[model samples]
Target chain A: MKLTDLVSRELVNLHLQGSTRDEILREMADVLAANGRLLDKDAYLDAVFAREQEGSTGIGFGIAIPHGKSAAVKTPSVAFGKKPEGVDWNSLDGEPAHLVFLLAVPETAEGNEHLKILQMLSRKLIDDEFRQGLLQAANVDEVMALLETVE
Target chain B: MISMKLLAVTSCPNGIAHTYMAAEKLSKAAEAMGVDMKVETQGSIGVENELTAEEIAAADGIIIAADKTVDKSRFVGKRLLEVAVSDGIRRPEELIRAFSEGDVPVYGQGQADAGSRLKTIQEIKQARKSRQNPVYRHLMNGVSYMIPFVVVGGLLIALSLGFGGHPTAHGMAVTPGSFWDHVLQVGTASFSFMVPILAGFIAVSIADRPGLVPGMIGGYIAANGSFYGSTAGAGFLGGIVAGFLAGYVAKWIKTWKVPQMIQPIMPILIIPILSSAVVAAIFIWIIGHPIAIVFSDLQSWLQSMQGASKVVLALILGAMISFDMGGPVNKVAFLFGAAMIQSGQYFIMGPIAVAICIPPLGMGLATFIGRRRYTKDERDAGKAAFAMGLVGITEGAIPFAAADPLRVIPSIMIGSMCGSVIAMLSGVTDHVPHGGPVVAVVRAVDNVPMFFVAILVGIVITALIVNLLKKEIPADEETEGVA
Candidate 1:
């Protein structure tokens, strides 16, 4: 239920290397795959892209929450990526996304668990302090430390 | 004395993003103004942080900003301001100011009206200015009530088919005197009340509680033209007339200046009696015959269509379903399909079901096929959209289409149209009121393979067309976070 439990050190990228949206999503999905949250990287990535075709999850304020509820996900999880150079997320406000969270939930996630996570994160995301902490974090541990302060 | 604490509730239709945003704005404004408050949000997951009965009692005022219904029985005696959820977002401080100025009206002693109509001349003017939204609102009010009946009744009948029905020449028929027969009967019983309740609520929405009796009466008459010695009863179309006519009549009567002594009895006696009589007379003479002709013509036209002609109808419905992605137009199309289910025209819904799933499914597939066009974040979101679309949640495509409505809308509409036409052409039939291959694979749909094929073809078309239309991803823009 906690976002920390769903997000892992392996999935958190302190410095994003991808210049394009596709590269960032692939790198982050690979991170999730490495962390054992994804069963099939290709299937999961397809789901992620499919979700984007529906709408950009770049909800504004330099953030993008790229998420999918797919059978390829082993667990409900979130992967974080930081892009100081920013990436085109085609956000609601047409701003590029800087802080990216790739959320994956099982197709059978009981009672829309992903949406609940998104809502919980949305409130925290609205706070200036939380974004400041995440942006200023240096390492994986530092990111974890910042995420722990979600409440 | 210091101002007493106030409480508010905010909700919108989706109840996810906007509802929370509104709640946040309202509570933040309240806190900044040094007022003690609690804000409850009715969201997709349901009510959060509900107000206690004691809290309702202790509150000095309440603001109910909602697009959907919010039960106010608990706040019966409180000073309340009821407005659209937009007010909670855009004018939260202004709403709080009204409470500070003690301008809101107290409810539960009588009707819990939104605000008092203290002015006479301006009241009519105020009413006219608000008319545009009210007509649509009133119709939605009727549709809202009518939907529960349709969904539950239709589903129960579907369940009856799944559990207790065997196919006849026309469709599934429950065995006489069996338990499934009883279930089917119950569902039929529910459907029987659909028009009356729809008419009743629309009138109540328009004319308040006084419209209830006359509206129901007029609706009952409309639904059963035997009262006027007509062979074919006026259908839902007639119900609309009855509801609006009764509502306006009751509303007009409320504008009358009865003597002070007669005012007490006016609402209970004179208004209901006069309006009911007038509505009945008008409906029997003027409305019923004309609407009956139109309704039957429509029913027959729909019923008689076949082959290519049927596909045309299916195409229009499919496009409508995917056009706004569950907005008002989509709801109207859905309601049309549901009405068909009640009349035992299962094939129309067959196509609608296919159309409903294609937008999300096709959009999801588009991301998969054209990976180079989308950003890394988008591709990931596409996976989720694909999954949601598979399960028949059309909203999965919303985020994508909302951002680029021009290309996305046309693409999804075409995809849905292709799927719908295919479903109709393939002779697919859906017994259940709901859509998607989920329903079909579960045996709620007839010709399951064809249904799957229709969905598949539509998804391919959508994915191909959209990916073809999509431009290459834009370079990153300047970020906006101070952090």
Candidate 2:
């Protein structure tokens, strides 16, 4: 039930190297694939892009949450990627996204614990202090500690 | 300010993130602002922390942050602020501040929270008003205002007569200058205002404030038959007529395109004076003549029925008593029986006695039988009607008659006629001028058992028929009665 349970050290990137929105999504999707959370990387990326086509996942205030519920996903997982220099993801407020949370939800998922944790993260992102903590986190342990309070 | 509470409902199309996010943001903002608040979240997991009716009713304001449709019927009378889900997340404090600043619109007052804003409150009210039968709407408005006066007057008189009255040769009477006597007079005073208030408010519903003076003045004339050189006033029926007369007259005068200088004083000065004079003249001269003629004609008709069959006579007497419910027609029949009691015809008084109590008793039973057919106030009035019927106060049925005259009047009339026929055929005889089982209790009636049987049959007939004729009042239509 803990938010840390859905997120692992392997998926946490303190410094994202991607300069564009496409490169950042590919990098985050690669992290989920590397952790064996996705069965097919291309199909998962297609779902994410379809969601983006419907509406931008960039929700202003230096945050972008690109989520996809597809059959390619084998397990529910969250990949956290932070860029010191923000990237433009066509956010609502037209601000660059500094904090990126990539969510992978299986189309036929078994439990809703990860979804609940995602909801918690969505709610917490509205708080300036929580976003500040995410941006200033020095290492994966510090980031995990901050996210530990979400659940 | 510390006691204030806010209620909110948040929803979205996806229902996973935005719903809870908006709810969380609003909750956090409320916490920071030190406002007690509850947010009902309608998310993918389904409704959680649902707001209760009590909480919604007690809330100072409500916030509806939804991207999808949210049913707002439950929040009818509450102050509400509606915004998109994104606004709820980004501007939670601002939304709460709208409540603190009292900038929220009351739901059902022709205003919504977000889009589809109504142009003006008056336009919406007028639109709603026009949807119903205007006359029925106006009459209902009058009845709502008139109910309190009826309840207070009926209950007070019933108490005074039941507890402190003695069975007298004339009727039940309390000792002079006693506490019960004072209470009785106070009850009479309350009753005196019943017709005038009914008329005044009916006009208020029709022509607004300008119609009040004329309506009340016309009602005063209607209630006092002496103005028209008649013995009894026209009663609640007459009050209804006067109310419409004054209302339309005032409404007509309001339409005149008068000069700018005169327009300011029109509602206060010109409209009331002119309408009052017109309604008073019309009631006193035009309506009064017909009422007097009807009273005298009924008096002679009853006199001519002296040699008629006993069953036919009982039927006529019962019909008269319940027809207008203490109005002109009722008064004529009652006086004839009282006069006959002076002539040693005790049997004539028996049927009259049974008929007198049937309307109120039947209505009271009807309310009990069909709870959904009457409003909360009417159900309360029903209980009081029973007590008043026991004490032989015919005016107890006036509220019911005034409310649904067509159906209720016919139903009560049939019940009274049946009871009257039963009392007559069973050879029941009442020595006192009064009516009801109370007279039999005081040893004023012969064949006491049959007297009760007559009343029971009448009550059953009325309760069954009225319930059959009436439809169930819709839940939305059961707004809390003004009374």
Candidate 3:
């Protein structure tokens, strides 16, 4: 229902260090794995890449929501990663993605609750200040504080 | 006087979270500004807290903070400001203060947005660079313009005949030297104007302003047939050829590099003159008689359809009318039926009218009778769709088709086909070019009982079939939806 419920401070990275799009997806997937959200890290990464092949999750506005609905995911969760230098995520507008919301939904998540979380993030990202605040956040606490206002 | 009431709409992607966030932010900002504000949210679920017509009418300034396309048709003639939903979240004060600032541009006043047109211009340039199908676009433009004229002409003639004329050897005849006779005469005159308007606007759609004169001239010639010294002109078929010829010739002339002094007069003088001459010459010398021959022959063939053949024709026409649900195929079939009305073949249009209402009315009924088969958004849409069907608009079924085309399309098509076939078999005849019970109530239809029966049966069949085909959402979600 709210970002704080799906997103944790441990998964919010103020500075995401990755060059290529795939590496960034893997890094974000690893965040979920480290937080015990995924049962298998490699499988989730593979699912994310498979979904990317259908179309880039880069939904323009310098934002990419790379997500996978896979059995590897043990729970529905979100991992926030901000790339300061921006990566070419093959976006709709061909712009570099500075803000990334990695969505992981369990294969059996019939409620589509993870999709709802993605909806919340996607809606707020339309606000330039929210994106800017999240991007400008000094640490995980600042990121968590901004996301708390999502409800 | 500044009107304190404000309306705002928020949307972005399919996510539910951000929409509420922005709405919360805007309401607070509106409160601070002493503005009575109501925010509407369009999310994955559906439109929540829709603005009533009264609220929309009473509101002084409107703000549309949407990241997706919102139909701005209703907001026409309103002082409106639209910004990204993010703007509402980030800069609400700036958006609200714009009402007092008087810098907000009025939207939907029959003008394209200045900034948005920049995209259209760029896209047009890109399209021209590739030379994509402008022909289809121009033809559709002609059809759109032609429709209103056809409706006016068709209904007037139908009403005049129904009220004032008796059955005659040839169609119906108004009483000589009576008030009914004058109404019939005026109605016939309106019908005669239909062809030229169709041709003129088709050309307008094709070559912009310059093609209008030539297209209209060509259409008049096509309709009269006497310009080419032939009887029965070419009918709507000839008008189509004339429209295309005039549009293209005008478009060709526009491409020529003229001197700067003469360029100013090209659209006003040179292009129209040259194009009209070309269209006249070609229609008279090359294509005019052949088109008239074909039109007349086809008109005779349609008038002769009887029994099983008529039922077959109605079935085909019905399926075509419902198949695309107001796409190119539907328009072509509708145009054919309207053109048939001009030729005094009322039965050809009878089934088409019935088919038109079946889809909308059926879909609406389906939602009501089989409530579990739809989500909450669909049930809400169902009410509007049903009402649209009563007035004979087929496009009301579009959302269901869009949601699940494979199932919805076939169901609606079957229902429309059955209705059309039954209407034809029962000898239902509509004089008016329009469909639905509203038109029938005005004595536009003969065999009115069968007409109603055909429509009711068709609506029921469509509702049953579509509901059976559609999978139900979890029932718990309905409770959640209300919550």
Candidate 4:
């Protein structure tokens, strides 16, 4: 239920090469697939797209958490993508996003478990040091290690 | 030689946006025409930059531009020009020119004969007031009663899902025989009355007691599509049409010759029957097919839309949510999502959920990120609105939009629409009728992470747009030197 348990080094994309929201989502879906955490990339993408329709997960402060629960997911997992050049995500403060957290949860997980993970991630992200460390994290391993501290 | 100052006042019902816009335009136009004008804006907190009694007494002319009632007793003895707020917004220059050309007439004095225009304005007001037939009054009454049903039904359905439903292999399903299931159904039944109530009231307003029977019957037909060859029928919109048809039919029938002794019975029997017959016939034969086609097309379009299709959908939902805040436009979108939930399409509600929260959430975030863009009152209201957004309340954004509609509406719309599209493209599905961050947290959202992302994106977009759009008031202007 926690970020450290749900996220792995393989799930992190250090540099997102895509320019558009779709390309980023596709790349994120692929990461979930590569980690064996997703059964169907298409379904996972559908879940992601569906969630986006409700509203952006960007709660502001240059951080975005995009998460979904779908049958396409083989297991509950989290994928971290950092866009240094800052994609035009239209952040609340008019700032481009530097840290992106894409969470892919199993469709059947207990509702409380999902909330626990979001609470953990949101609380930690609000801290200046925690977000700064995550932003400066040189690689996926560093990001994963930092997330483990929260766990 | 004697000279006099010209004073003008502008106001609208809500006392925001249009009121200020009209004031600004009028002031600018008056200045250009060399008219010494001091315009006061009556907004939510009452009047701002008020004119003194001496100034009013010295004015040779006065213009009152308002939709709501303005106290004209103060200017009764002066040369006054009265016009609708729309005329001020659309024709400020012409209004000023008319005043300069001495076209406005004096009132409340021996010179009343000199101001023919004043008599015409009075006649117009009288005509407008007299034109309000019983049908309009009854319709408004019905609508007033009906809104609570829609809100309660929609909110209860959403709450039931949030508290009771669990994700299943076949998507979200309520367990059979659950307490919440009963509650949910009860809520849905309340919503079912929305159309009937709307139509019935409109008729009652128009024709008084005579309009009630036909209105209710017409409303029933509108709600039930089997009579019209459609599955969903015309919904609330159909109710409106039915109400009008029934009212007019009943009114027409009232003119028929009956025994003078039976005149009282005519309203109870003949009018209701004739009106109901007309409404039923129209729905079954004339209007049914087109309404069915439109309803089916809407369903098909929603079902067929995929990934990229969300962008357009988001734009529309966002526009609706922000257009009038919680007014008719917002109701239309909200009702569309609720209807879709009954039809087992959860994805259509996805974008709507996102659109509903973005306005308040985004404004709340703006207050935290930047303090200069908002007034003290706005920042305070933003805090409360933020909490409202978590519960998926769209009315929370009304205060901000009212304060600066031109700038705020567009900002929230762009943000909300962007978030909505992203949610759609992400394939997020919401089984519930209502939306909010709280709903997502309660496992009401299918794609939890994408729900977060969608909200985050929306918050960012709204904040950015609002910040960018806000015109900064200079700091120096805030502090004036004191000797």
Top TM-score prediction, candidate number: 2
Q: Tell me, what's the RMSD of every candidate?
A: 23.2, 12.4, 20.2, 34.2
Docking class of 3: incorrect
Runs of candidate 4 exceeding 4 Å displacement? A1-151, B1-139, B168-173, B299-310, B313-416, B424-439, B442-483
- Model 2 residue A112 distance off true place after TM-score fit, in angstroms: 37
lDDT of 1: 0.73
Docking class of 4: incorrect
- Candidate 3's residue-wise lDDT over A1-151, tens digit each? 7878888988988678889998888888888998999999988888888867755667666888777767898988889999989999997668899999887777676565556556666657767798889878888888898999976
User: Candidate 3 has which clashing residue pairs, if any?
Assistant: A119-B15, A126-B86, A127-B86
Cα lDDT for residue A129, candidate 4:
85
Mind giving the per-residue lDDT tens digits that candidate 2 earns over B239-354? 99999999999999999999999999998999999999999999888999899999999999999998999999999999999998778999999989988988889899899999
**What is candidate 4's CA lDDT for residue B481?**
11
Per-residue lDDT of candidate 3, residues B1-483 (tens digit): 244888998886433444655677788878878889998888755687887655765787789887777766455567888887667666778888898878888764344333333333332222222232556555545654554454444445545555675543233456888887776677567656656776887798778799999999998887776776554566555676788889888989999999999998898889989999999999887876665565455455544544347878898788878876654356556767777777777887789889998987898899999999876666766776676576565656655664456788899899999999999898888776667665676667889999989999999999999988887754433422210
Task: Locate the minimum summed-lDDT window of 10 residues in model 1 chain A.
Answer: A113-122
| Proportion of native contacts present in model 1 | 0.12
lDDT, candidate 4, A25-101, per-residue tens:
78888888987889998988887787666545554556776667678888778888988887766544467777888
TM (B chain), model 3: 0.44
Angstrom error of the Cα, residue B364, model 3: value is 14
For residue B426, give model 4's deviation from the true position in Å. Answer: 6.1
State the lDDT of candidate 2 residue by residue for A72-129, as single tens digits: 9998889999998999999867899999999888887776777778888888988899
